[model samples]
Target chain A: MVDQLKPGKSIKDTYVFDLKMSERGMRINRLAEWLNGAENREAFKSDMDAVMDRFELTGEEKKLILDNDWLNLVKAGGNIYNVVRIAAIFDVGLYPLGAQQLGMSYEEFLETRNEKGAT
Target chain B: MAMIVAGIGTSHVPSIGAVVDSGRQNTPEWKPLFDAYEPVRTWLSDERKVDAVIVIYNDHACDFSFSKYPTFAVGAASEYAIADEGFGVRPLPPVKGDLDLSAHICRHLVYEEEFDITICKEMAVEHGLLVPMDLCFPQQGEWPVKVIPVQVNVLQHPIPTALRCFKLGAALRRAVESYDRDVNVAVMGTGGMSHQLHGERFGHLNSDFDNWFLDKIESDPQAICGMTHFDLMEQAGAEAVELIMWLTMRGAMTPDAQRIHRNYYAPMTTGMGLITMQDAA
Candidate 1:
């Protein structure tokens, strides 16, 4: 069924946040979803380890969040949007996270776009 | 009876909202994009007199977490709170929902159309719905029109297919037209043109594909409906598959709607595009 949906060509370095990925990233995502509240955000920010422990995030998952590895987080089944929430707790915004995911320096990433520093 | 006046398709990039909120819309880099929407705001308020908007957008792990995300959800609440979205709650007013119209549509979709949408009472809208609202209606204090948010799960896999999205739009038309109300409603589809924000392919933008999509959505929606999720992701980037939401707006319109205004801008990673159409009279 899945193969029927695929085209002849495929995209590299692109991860589709599909059902398999969603199931894989459930724990990390649950922890990230809690950030929607101010109190939860503060709790995560104040003591990252405690919050991670409470969420029961695996060691690899904890490492991904700690390393600020946005790409790896996605690889570990973390949806990009939820990963964005996790990144925010560490004061990392989407653009910088995207830069890290692409293995580009922030300056280099900005240079690739039509409107640089517009946001 | 309620009437469908216009259909709108726009990118709901989060950065666009940040630009508007920060009052930097007139800056050289952002002016072209912001200026494009000025006429849309005027058209909705002055020309269309749109009393309500059915905003078709995706919730990005804000209101519906991945734990139990629904494939399709409809907001039946009287008011929707603005979500924090991790950074902080945006300094925006709560969105007003037309409960009577929403509940009617929800019932119609489930019983008559067999869409089986999850009905939401207390959905906190994030940038997906709000950014498009900001684009089409730059409000001062209160929004000019009430909104009925139709949330789709575009982030997760096993999302409704392009054809399914288009069919939902068609069903929406029936629901809107059947409502015995003296109101003009606009259907707004918010999401991508083309851009990827994940993996090594981050910052992907395909202007050619985006432009093609804009044209096809207006003239030949069936072509778009024929595309699989993989086809869209392969050609337009993984995240660009969100464009399927636009079909919901297009499907609600007449087969030969008149395209009034169209604009496309690839400023950052996303190919920000806007197209407005009115059903043929």
Candidate 2:
């Protein structure tokens, strides 16, 4: 399903969030979107497995969330913004998540940025 | 009669809002970006005397999810809530809306221009709108100017075309002018100046493409009007496609609009670009 949405010409590491990706990642995306609510964040923090069960996330989806695999979550059709919400629960920011996705330490990623302090 | 006094094109990076909220504007890393807006803040409030703003921005999966996303959504509510995008909501007051003006724009777009925009009575504005507002306006207890939120779907695919977004701005101009009340409006195009945050190409920044886009958006928007989503994503990363929203602001102005102020800063991942324009005298 995720492979179906690739454009005729593809960027090396970019993911285009299309209808198919949206449909495939609906459960995880919806669960992440719900994290916008404070109560929902708390609910997930405590008994996360129950919340995952309620959202009916697949075993792989559960593993991605538990394993802190930001890149796989995105590759599995999770929208980047929705994935950011899930990562925020663990106090991970967009920069850190990107660093992890790029297989670099946060400091190494900061060195690549023009304004390291901007983070 | 209502008039669009000016148009502002800016990057609505979320971190800017965080800096403003945390009182880190004086810090070296952010001072330059915040300082650039000081003159803009003064100009809009003092010189232009803008009463309301039409903000063209995209929802970053905050308020409206993929479940039911509108390609083009216009806010017709009396107020808009600041969205909590995972982090706590920014320390800002609710955005006051100009319902009469909003309704007027909505009616004109549908009836006269034939742009079938979704009318949102309850819309929660995220960084796309807030960051621009934070940059251009100073808030006392309440915001200085009321807003009419115009949300474009730049997140998901099959979103509005660049031409369509521009046409929406043209329709918005007509909508604003058709209103009977006398009001000065400023249309703000917020988001993008090239930066991606998705995958291995996460830290993409194209200052050259950003500069070229700024030049075209000001001088020959027609050149950009034909840009395909693939072209934009290829040149400037995928998320930078949000630059299309800026065309909506350009489309609202006269073809010979005077470029008043221009600034570009690429200190971080996103190339923060700003351009202010006014209709030729």
Candidate 3:
């Protein structure tokens, strides 16, 4: 059967969390979604490998989380909101994660913003 | 018959909610942002006397997961719990819902309007809905107005087109007016002026586009309704496409609606913009 719904046109650095991306990142997204609960966050914090294993994340996916690679995680189909959940567990707030993605130090990125004190 | 008294469009940035929760609203950096909302809050609860609000917001993977996401979901529950968006639930009272009105709108959309929306008997709202409520309404022990949550899928691609969202709002106005109850209702279109929160384009902000949008949303919404998601992402940033939800509020109002209040503030990542509209008599 022909697929009726067409994929969104590719933008430079943006990854639209469409059906294909969602399917590819399902394991990681689900794992991150579970972090909504405090108990699950603690379990993941205690034994990272076990939690990742339980979620059936692939080796590459596990490596992405292990390396704390925010940019590549999105490339690996990790939804930004879901990736945020994982980042929170590592004490990485959105601004710092964003700065890392932009290849700038947190302070450097703050300088780029209109109001540095906004954070 | 119920009347649509006004429409509110505001950015529902999660960090703003954090500022409120952490008692930093009075701090130097955040005070201006919170202070901007003071008059707008008074107008909502006092002048308009909005008894209930239909909040059109998108869930940020908090309540519904990727497993079974709905394109459009309407809350039919009597009350909704605050979602724990991977951090923790905000310390806010459960939002009360108008069950009878919700059911009426659900039925009208499905049968009368041919908009087959998922009816959620249970929904936990995230920052998308709560942040706007925090800014617009006064929170004592409980919310002053009942809420009817209308969740849209802006996260996943192939989401509804910008025009479809506006049409949904028009349909909603009909649904609300048809009800036998005599109540003053307001529709809140929450989320985004401009900011992308992922990948290398994460910190993108477009104040010019945000300002243009704030103007067009009131004066020439038809121009906005014709824009594609790609166009919005390119010009405003990826996540800023959530601005389509504002069309729902515009769609629910008169084309000649007067803009009562307007404010623009870009802090860190998001372009926080706010506007209130009331239909011309």
The whole-model lDDT of each prediction reads 0.90, 0.90, 0.91
Against the correct fold, how does model 3 do in TM-score? 0.97
Candidate 2 per-residue lDDT over residues B35-134, each given as its tens digit:
8888888899899999999999999888998899999999999999989888877778999999999999999998899888899999999999998998
Model 3, which residues run further than 4 Å from truth? Answer: A1-9
Q: Supply the TM-score for candidate 1.
A: 0.97
Where is model 2 more than 4 Å wrong at Cα? A1-6
Which should have the higher DockQ, number 2 or number 3?
A: 3
Clashing residue pairs in candidate 2 (N, C-alpha, C atoms within 3 angstroms) = none
lDDT of 3 by residue, B19-39 (tens): 888888888778878888899
By lDDT, is 2 or 3 better?
3
Q: Which regions of candidate 1 are displaced past 4 Å?
A: A1-10
Per-prediction share of native contacts kept: 0.87, 0.69, 0.78
| lDDT over C-alpha atoms for residue B206 of model 1 | 88
Q: Give TM-scores for every candidate, taking all chains together and pairing residue i with residue i.
A: 0.97, 0.97, 0.97
Kindly list the per-residue Cα lDDT of model 1 for residues B45-103, writing each as its tens digit: 89999999999999998888888889999999999999989888888889999999999
Per-candidate count of clashing residue pairs (backbone under 3 Å): 1, 0, 0
- Pairs that collide in candidate 1 are A18-B157
Error of 1 at B25 (Å): 0.8
